[model samples]
Target: MELGVFLFRPLIRNRADFKQAEETLKKSEVWIRNIFKSLKEAVFVITPDRIFLDMNEAAQEMFGYTKEELVNRPSAIVHIDHEQYLEFGKKMEEVINKGEITNFQFKMRRKNGEIFPSEHTASLMVDNEGKPIGIVSVVRDLSEQKKIEEEKEKLQAQLQQAHKMEAIATLAGGIAHEFNNALTGVVGNIELLEMRLPDNKIVTEHTEAMKSSSHRMANLTSQLLAYARGGSYQAKTISLSDFVEETLPVIIPNIGPSIRIDTDLPRDIFKVNVDSAQMQMVLSAVVSNSSEALGGDGRIRVITSNEEIDAEFAKSQPGLRPGRYVCLTVEDDGEGMDEETVNKIFDPFYTTKFMGRGLGMAAAYGIIRNHGGWISVDSEQYKGTVVRIYLPAIEAEKKVKKEIITEPKLDIAEGEGTVLIIEDEEMVMNVTRAVLVRLGYHILEAKTGKEAIEIAKTFDGQIDLALLDIKLPDIQGDKVYPLIMKARPNLKVIVCSGYSIDTAQG
Candidate 1:
């Protein structure tokens, strides 16, 4: 009887323990379900037949469907492409056979027919006995991620473009330097030749041609300097409407008779502080480009308007600022450019026309940028082109008359001085010396900065002025100037360069 009682008590204890264990397991399952529901990622439980069994709140929100609409629905509802749907089925089979598959990317459709990129992971759901129940998938929206990636790529491309422009600017600077040195010799010699030649019509005509050619070369060098961001100019307050009016006589004849010219300016002209010469260059480049676009058949319109750009608008432009601007626009009804051509219009040496120098628009762009302004080009293939220039506006202030103070013209016989010429180029040095000699000044020459200092120190006579070239093989001309100054304290110094002297370089 005692043995039977002991066996019955042991059986009772085992049954009670099993019941507690079963209750704990049910609580754990409830907790796990709550955890799945709380997840930010969409969790979907799909049957082997691709029917939706259950889903979390995220899954409902992601598909734009409520729990009632999604349950028992075919998983094909979220797949926009039919082939993608078939691919999903194969992936499900893979997950079931291989235990799990992760980071499967696909396009998903919402209930509203909106589609978005998504990435998801799937694993086989099973019962305690290891029998397959359904497939559990955790899906993540990749739309924002893809957008970030695309933006990153665009920024990288812009950086590469900036680097390329920098390289081009360096090359342009070197070319301008060399070209300017050559022009100095050509122009100086031509002027000397003109002074010596007799006043015959034929002789004067040929010399004038030489002068014209030299002037054109000078203009070309100036444009290259502009492209290199080394072109120098003085900015002053100017009225845009007045400037255009004054420039019309110069511009009209060059545009040809077939192309009609029109103007639309405000009664009160927009005022901007800018370099008049550079501004003129900008206008000329735009009009010339328009004339070519028209092929001597269409109309060119010059329009001016006031504008105020906000930060939001300026954000799209890389170097633009938020402020009031005088918007000067030049539009033409000519053969316009395609997108590819328009994209490269501002690049130096890039041209669409057969006879173009390719520096017009590039110089215009650089000049505007140097003046703290922006230039935009818009064109449509076979339609037309519109070039817009935005310059900062200034408040109404006293119009100061720019005083034109000219140097007193000195006769070659009256001129008297001992001038020092420091230059590296032999032709430029010789021509410069001849000009001074003709002006009745004694010349002291040096081919380099070191040689110039040595000559200045040893010279016993009065050194009236020093014409120093900015570029030297031994040292920068600015650095050498102080040494020369120390040697000759009372001497006047004229620093010269073939290129523009920017403030930093000056």
Candidate 2:
């Protein structure tokens, strides 16, 4: 059972037989070394006492060690941690005594002290009589395989998140659409009622309250659509100074006095082409976040500035072109966020506030993107947060000035030219017709798009205006619009929808 006897012994009866035995023994030793060296997987032999007995060329390359350096070294040299070395030694003893061990995972350190994942299988090396002598292990590096697995997991998570956001957006859009239609009806009816009770102070006060409530409800619906619609926006040239001024009064009262507000609007007007309504929602969302971060006590500074992004600057933002932009920055002196929190702030349903639907930041992001603009957020744990919105700017000559006009009193009960009202919702149509009727216009009504087209064609084309709803039973109100236009091309048509302009497009 001895190692020397088991490998070198041969039957010999003469001098020639002795010489042949000696040659055969040398050849067998060469063949064994060659077989081990030719293996693709790293192969090494360790003694029962945990010493490195022998290793092949593949093993040398794998561990960045020479055969002379590894031959008598402790088997623990390949493992980084002392605890791991002791653990592997115990496992190796089991492999030497009990047959074999398969697929044992371990972290191995290379010559440069870099650690990588590996899997190894070991079997007992035995003598001619089957007594165990040493352990032979085959090791395979799993670094590349592990990387692939991790990347696949990351991609899977991203796909799942995208699907979830899309589902929520669709739901929000539907709810907003229905709610806006109902609000339109309620508000229209309340106005008509107020007109009838102008002289009655008691009734007028009640109607005023109802009108304010409906207006608030309409604002809520607008925010819902801002979060949901994944399409283009309706952009108009508007003065940024005027917009901020108009929003402050509404913002100041609701945010309370605990939060002090500061503004830095330039004397020279900055004009950006964007949707005013969506931008208002964006500002509301940004300020709401600031107030929440403040927890009812902090300062907010809103500043408007002109920005020119050159090619070098644009390189920082992929897909952005060099251009002039109007920057609206909102800075808050409140509880800020860490890197992890900031990364997920714009993701739908992500929130830190106690009272929130988790859609404020997400809606702000969507609205800005839809307006063909860019938004960036900078924050530190206690230093506070700054959110910057960059919108495309119009030329000086293209700037639009909004003039406030005071309307003189008009007689509310006088007859005028015939007007067409096309709406699918009965309640909405009825309330809208009554309001127009009270405004001294003869009303022509249709509960469906087809009925409206018939009415427009048969009439003498004297219709002053067409109040049309985009959604209809048989056809889209937009499609009906063109057909009605055939009868009266010069008709002043107004299309109404509860949904976003993109979703409502026929």
Alpha carbon lDDT of each predicted model: 0.79, 0.76
Q: Clash number for every model?
A: 0, 0
Q: TM-scores of all models?
A: 0.74, 0.68
Q: What would the per-residue lDDT of candidate 2 be over residues 1-506, giving only the tens digit for each residue?
A: 22233345677789998898878877876776677789989988877777888888898898999989888889888998889999888788788667767559899999879899999898777765677777778999899999988777755654554466567778878788788878888888788777887899998889989988888887677667777763335567687877998898887877858899999988576688777777887898889888888888989999998888788766555434577788899999887988777767777667675226656777887677556567778899899999998877776224322221222333335568777888878888788778877877888988888898898889864887777777888888769888988877877666667864332111
Per-residue lDDT of 144 in model 1: 98
lDDT of 2 at 51: 84
Model 1, span 1-506: residue lDDT tens: 11112112222257778687656556666667777789999988888778888889999999899978978888898999889899999898888778765559999999999999999888786654566668879999999999989877755755565567667777887899989888888888877887777576787898889989888888888988877777667667788888887887787888779989899978686678777887888899889889888887889999988888889767555567787788899998888898778767878878687227668888888788777778887889778888889877775223211221223332335388898888998988999898888878999999899999998899998998888888888988879888998898887777777765332211
Distance from true position, residue 4, model 2, in Å? 13
TM-score of 2: 0.68
Regions of candidate 2 where Cα sits further than 4 Å from its true position: 1-41, 48-51, 54-101, 111-113, 230-232, 236-350, 353-358, 368-415, 501-506
